[model samples]
Target: MRKDVVPVSSPSPLPPLSPPAGPPPCPPARRVSLPAARPVRLVLCLSPVLLAGCWALADRPVASEGASRLAAADPGWLLAGAALTCLTWVAAACVRQGSLPDKLPPGLLLASQFAAGAANHVLPGGLGAHAVTLRFLRARGVPLDRATASIGLYSLARSVTRTLVLLAFLAACPARRRLGELVPDGPVPVPAAAVAGGALAVAGVLLTVVPPVRRPVTGLVRAALADARAVHGRPCRVLALWGGSAAMPLVQAGTLVCVGTSLGLGLPWEQVVLAHLAAGTAVGAVPAPGGLAVDAALVWTLVSFGAVPAVAAATVIGHRVLNDWLPLLPGALTLSALIRARAL
Candidate 1:
């Protein structure tokens, strides 16, 4: 009846209907890219800063004398430094093997160490070397937990020994005692003991809070206690291995002192120990490859605090040339050989 009353207007043109809107869509998640290796670029960025720092510190008249002293350093000292590095490797292997099974073999340990050292020098934070060591041990059928425990134990043993040496030196020296007082109740009186206690406390906290660290810490504790038991049975081997590892840092400190002497700067043994330990620790914590720029700055700063700026600069410079760069050659060669031999 309605259709009869209305003119057929194309089915009365259906009223416009709006499509229902769904919930607003979320933004797509962004992806992050991994960092790329750029060794040459990193070196370029760091080298200029190192050179400038050295130059700025070398401005004093004392620099001339330091230059002369550097020229006259006994070649014997250089030989001794190299020997110390060798001893370090041997001690490292011994420590590694001590925590591992008897069937793992010493050769693999040494190869792993050499490879790791090379990686440390070339890569940031020496993580590359650490990774290599981890993978190598893993390939040898070492469980991750055991490998982690062994590495931690060896490192802890070395650090404890080195810290004790520095503490002894600090206690024996008056200048260091005075310097310690200057920093508003600083680590002045007993640097080593204080640092060790601090490290233990920090590690204890880390074990309690961090899941990754907890497992490793517990494993390490067990391994170390077991090692203590074994040492009680064969105290000689443990002592020799750890003792040798511990001595390596002393050799390093002695070398730094010799460098100071060669620069005609009578930096005390205590100060020298302070410089080496402080600088080495700081640099090792940095992410830079072998802490190139950071290490140089740290060494310069430590020595300068106790000596003429010129002498400090010269000492750092000469030490780098004599110690750091000199070792790089052999380390590089060893790395190449290991690579070619497929030992790494």
Candidate 2:
């Protein structure tokens, strides 16, 4: 009908918006069952009882006497001994730091070491500190297996170095005698010492050799020969670590000598070193916190072998005060810092 052609502009179709993906599947919503709350209630009720027992132990006659004596020990000797211990820990930290692929900060690692040491003194069983150290390393991305292997290797290296140093000391003073009175006719043979030395040698050799372990054991041997070349591939650093580790025992033995001299026990350095090593090794097997009972027993046994009764007791007591308690304050503080920092 001749209507004028009109142009119709239809509206453009709108694009549909898809719904946003839901919260990434909610991660399967792991169901975590926390520990029952009963133990917390029990602890709240019994805490006072536990504290009372601690007080009782602290109030014991022997504990009181020891505390008094510890308070009265020479400040200089205590400071010097503490300094040596700090040096030992530093060496340990250095070795650990050197072994890592991504080396941890030196300060943090040292803090962890000190914290671990403090824990070793307070916690039951010998592995407390080591466990803390492993956890610390694990948190920092070191695989558990590798961390354990590294720590074990470092400990072995330290022990080997210590043994070698002790042996060298013995060799240098072969004629040394115990604290017992001189025999009118001749010296009594110390069969016990000889047996101990022989046993140590055998155990050390067996542990160092053998297959499967032969790999790591071989590493130790090559490291020793090339001076840690096989381990870190840097002989000088490895040798330095070993040498530093050896110095710890030497300084420790020297502390014993100082104790003997101060207490007028007149115990020979060689005799003391032998006894010290034996006692240290034996007591280390004990599970008590810091090997407290074990350490006391070791000192008593070592000193009693030849020392005059009173002097021996005094030396033992004095050594504990000078060596153990004095550094505990700083060690504990360091440990606390580590925990607070979550470095260990």
lDDT of 2: 0.62
Clashes, model 2: 1
* Superposition TM-score, candidate 2 onto the true structure: 0.64
lDDT of each: 0.62, 0.62
As for candidate 2, its clashing pairs are 223-228
Instruction: After the best TM-score superposition of candidate 2, give how far the Cα of residue 331 lies from its true spot, in angstroms.
Output: 2.9
Off by over 4 Å in 2: 1-63, 71-74, 98-102, 174-230
lDDT for 276 (candidate 1): 76
RMSD of 1: 12.9
Worst 10 residues of 2 by lDDT: 175-184
lDDT of 1 at 257: 70
